[model samples]
Target: MGSMEEPSPETNYTKPLGIRFIEYIKRSNISYKTHQVIVLIVTFIAYASYHAARKTTSVVKSTLDPASDEVSLNSLPWRRRPFSWILGDGWAPFDGSDGTVLLGEIDVAFLAVYAIGMYFSGHLGDRINLRIFLTIGMVGTGVFTSLFGIGYWGSIHSFYYYLAVQMLAGLFQSTGWPSVVAVVGNWFGKKKRGLIMGIWNAHTSVGNITGSLVASALLQYGWGWSFVVPGLMIATIGLVVFLFLPVTPESVGVSEEDESDSPKKSGAEVTSPLLISSRAEVKDQPVGFIEAWKIPGVAPFALCLFFSKLVAYTFLYWLPFYISHTAIDGQYLSDAAAGNLSTLFDVGGVLGGILAGHISDRLDARAITAASFMYCAIPALFFYRSYGSISLTANVILMFITGMFVNGPYALITTAVSADLGTHSSLRGNSRALATVTAIIDGTGSVGAAIGPLLTGYISAKSWSAVFTMLMGAALIAGLLLTRLVVAEVTAKIEESRSRRGSTSRSQPAVIDV
Candidate 1:
């Protein structure tokens, strides 16, 4: 028998359908700048759909376990103790005396699994076709998200069923951040990453607002539609992603290395040997999980994000419920109104993310910028808690400010900071570590995201004030975690200023020269 020969370097192999489409686009003369724009828009929409699906559960929470007469009965002047408790009228399993605790457990179960899946997802993202990975995640997320809502139409109230669906949804949702960030990082360099990512990060707030509005509006039809609509929307968007997303520049035969050095933004250059060697090296020696964590600034940023996400996710999950239950002008709001009003918080978050990104870019200090935002969030939280209930105007104003401070660091860390660390000079231009680093940081933060809502569920039953206290404590610690990094940034700035001054003085003509 004749021995089989290995494929030659010049031999053409069967490419995936997505890659073939990308190659077709390349041959049709699309420019590099156009491809970059496509990358940004596709990723932005893709991740936004993920957030949109996640937001449905929070909006529908009120309908699931509504406030009972116990709340109104305790509101009377004659009552000794104001009994703010969940009564048995809610859906089974969640309506029992331990209903609130049970609800919190669902959040814990979903996030715990999400956190664990994140680690593995990141590892897999590095090795697989990101386009396929992301599409599977989005489609799976839609299926599971819809299943949770189907329970309503089916008249199913088993706690375990809903819990299982949510947990599975989280596992799929875990595929989003690492994949999107890694793809975006591959396209854009660090030149203006903070501002670019900041603007792009607005997708999160936009998705939340869209989800809240959609879900709240559909509540009149049925709470089931609230979840089902967003679920369908994401599934549809997933199809778009599968068709259009270019996972990396190379996937379409565009060399990012050549683009980086090219004077014009044309795609006429062939693949350079340096680019090929770099890719080969990365494929052979991908960064390990432990090694990614060991990158300078990774640990501090990861720890800071832990506390940052705790505060952010707590508000994401419970702010609507808190607003509905708390009296504004001695009147209670309907669940729909509360959900609609909650969009203001996300509106503020959009501005905060943009501002944080611009400031970090201008200052060239990611750590200091993020730490400052976390510090400011402390006062914002206190003010919102103290004065937010006075009037509708006050509530909107204070909640907006609170959201700005709270989400600024979160946006900065998850985007610009994560990208910066992922491509640290220490990596020596091997870009394989980007996904792994992103995963570890976000995965650690997901643990805090899990803890926050879980604690808020139990603490809110006792006192809302205690929940604020916990958030404030988390903010303070988040800022403190970045102290060393902030100092380093400050020192680097001072040295740079001195060096510029010395160069200016030397360059000036001497007045005493003949």
Candidate 2:
């Protein structure tokens, strides 16, 4: 087996200070189990911080364009609109009548670039050291996130400035999901990946919740602080990730003996026939984009996720605005209150992700689990849109349910499903495909993510009902996309069950007669 010391002299020279620190730690008497735990915690916090920063824009949107019926800036005795602002009302271009559409455009700019960048970043992640790739992404994301906030204090209202910053931030954000998923997949195998990743995936909702609370809390001070604080947070966590993240077992000199003993505790079955054979001979070549797309389940799951993300991200970016604009029991919520309330959706999402993962693992059927979630989300969306305005309790309950169903398949596909496809048997244990496959699936989904928010902006001006209809239709389509795969899994499961029963009968009858 090759040792960590086998890298070229140039590669060693270019190693970050964090990699050196990790090497120093590895010299100590640490167990493989300890290293596994650290990987989980560090990656969790790192990605969560990324989401937290991404979420700031959504929470602060209402403050950028306060509703006309609400108390105006002029009504406040202590506060006055700044003279440098283009409009004496709210923030310039964004505060205008076309503000919602502009907001949607900004979302499209960010997510469109994000979707495009994902393809390249995935390829890069497979070739380069993941720790370095991930750290650079987080830091870049922080810088751009803060730059968006800096525009407020600088009295700069150029629409292009915000648009450009968002575009850059999206590019950086594209690095996060693929890198982290690849790292986790490196450490774990397919034994119970769905359930394990499902619980781990809570980081997404947790980050959203944290971002909403933090941004909402700071809205009273200034909208800029909302972005600045989260920006600083992700940047800080990036430093921590650079310091301690181990890219793979081989990188830390974990012995073969340690790996053999570690899977039981780690929930990874490292001894699986495929993995065992693959690890026997190291393949330096990574899978190409065209090759990854050719993998059997990859294309269908990717398409399903496209529609799935459309529904989920629409709510992610615009739900707070919707909550604040629409009345609940004849009362409209303040920006902060609405932002805070929007977190219930993510709260339900956390649970839904875990439940979906557990069900998929138990059934050993990823497509069936994902498709069912999408089917349920249709009714959930309808109920929330129709009855959510009736009362606060009803709104919360319906919204939570809607979030659960909408995010369930999304969570399953992005994490467990992507990992599974990346490590499919046809690859013959070529683990290098993990990042590229993950990128293809998620990159395709991001296109829909961009479209969802962009369309919501235009459609919302007409009627919120139309928006609900679009979401429900998307959810239905998402389920339909998975039908073929779901049927295959069902048929395979039936055959396996019959084989097991036949084996049990054959093994028991002869001995009983004797």
Candidate 3:
């Protein structure tokens, strides 16, 4: 009571306005937990959209009745200049040789263009406005996805037209990962990111399941409808992201992690909606391409991702065909049944990813978790080769296990570890380079993605055993590469701690939130 009369002038002057606001939150128990949930949901939608668009091609091929498949290039009624000359100016062509070739090219053409576009799309996302870029990308992807279905409705038979659609569709698909990874990286920190991102990224597997279910349902009625469902779904989700998806947390007034500890409003602080343009504008130092590549652990990590993706994509493209055509002394699954069964792979993949994430989070060793799972997958791949001859049930079980192990590492290394390396403390606390860093890794991975399916197609055309051997080699190589990254990370942490303590035994610096 005596001291109240002399209320300290200095106490009022030094008290922070920001601290009071923070205290207000605690007193009311206000939390961003709701916002985090919304972010995850939207992110899931975006990833699902990507898979829906990607999986339509598989469905279309699956439902094709080999009995009804006829070559009609020459007999087509168009009577175009090329057709007239080839058919002796009056007689329609006798055989449909050109038709099959054109059809074959259409699918592979899409894959070729997709690999090329992935390399450059990340740069576009970083340089342009995210909302506009993502919106346009979604629209383009959806339109092209629908076009394939529309072609069937229109009775379109020109192979060239489908090739064009596939190429354009592939181009649009490139927009997904670069943009999604950039936004997600901005939302989270390196702390427990492996676990968090692992769970979050399971949308990849979920999308695969959703797409398979939708595709299988439609294939029984009309294969064309398969493409339309996914296309419309993507368009619908695009609208939601346009209306509600925040570019970054800062866009909503929450301070980014880098700024959470500092009260002063430094120009260097990253703000949100975590959009790439905003990131570029606010970062203290923008990393160059050369600098990003030169980072100690980045190259090895990128190589690991490349090889892992190679195996994953190979399975994605070829598994249904294998089950339908080569299963157990040619006792094959019907087209619809095969498509439905492969969905189980993604089901297992989702569980595997979540488990891997949680384990890595507790141990704080993404490399070890990734490597261990891949190594475990080797036996399952061998199991498929052995029991694949025994019974359909055994084959399905083995394939599901293979999917779980392979996809776990694929999701973890690409999302969680990429973010960690991208925002490593060596960057002078700038997290703005996430898009570029992720692009470099995934873009390099696209090379392997391009190679894997083509190699599998050719190898399976020869002997399925060769395909198994190739996948095994890829998994082993990926594990070795990640082992290198684990060593580098540990060494870097030791060096950093040493730098904080003086030669005379001073206290070590406190570890920052990852």
The numbered model that scores best in lDDT is 2
User: lDDT tens string, model 2, 1-514?
Assistant: 3233444465445444565665555654345676678889989999999889988886566566544223221111112222224323567667888775566568778888999999999999988989989999999999999999998899888888999999999999999999999988887777788888999999987797788679867767777888999999999899898887877766765543664647755777657888655675645678899999999999999999999999998887678778888899999877557767887998888889999999999988999999999999999999898899999999999999999999999999999999999889888778888889999999999999878877876798899999999999999999999999989998999999999999999888564554
- Provide the global lDDT of candidate 3 against the true structure: 0.68
| Model 2 clashing residue pairs (backbone) | none
The 10 consecutive residues of candidate 2 with the worst lDDT sum are 71-80
lDDT of 2: 0.83
* Global local distance difference test of model 1: 0.81
TM-score attained by model 3: 0.76
Q: Can you give the lDDT of residue 194 in candidate 1?
A: 89
Question: In TM-score terms, which candidate is top?
Answer: 1
- Listing every candidate in turn, what is its Cα RMSD in Å to the true structure after a full C-alpha superposition? 6.7, 5.7, 10.7
lDDT, candidate 3, 1-514, per-residue tens:
2122221454323323332343345553122454466667777788788887777665444233221122111111111222222223111110143433454566567766776676567666666655556767787888889888786568676666777888999899878777777777777776767777877887786786677568656754455687887988887777766665555555444444333555344556554455756555556355667777776667877898788889887777666556666667457666446646666777777777877888888777788888888898788788888687588778778878988898888888778777777777778567666766777788777778778877776687678888999999999998888887678657866876787665436555666896
How should the candidates be ordered by TM-score, best one leading?
1, 2, 3
TM-score of 2: 0.84
Q: Given candidate 2, what's the lDDT at residue 454?
A: 72
Instruction: Estimate, for each residue in 378-468, the C-alpha lDDT of model 1 and write its tens digit.
Output: 9999999998989999999999998999998899899988888888989887777778889999999999998887788679889999999
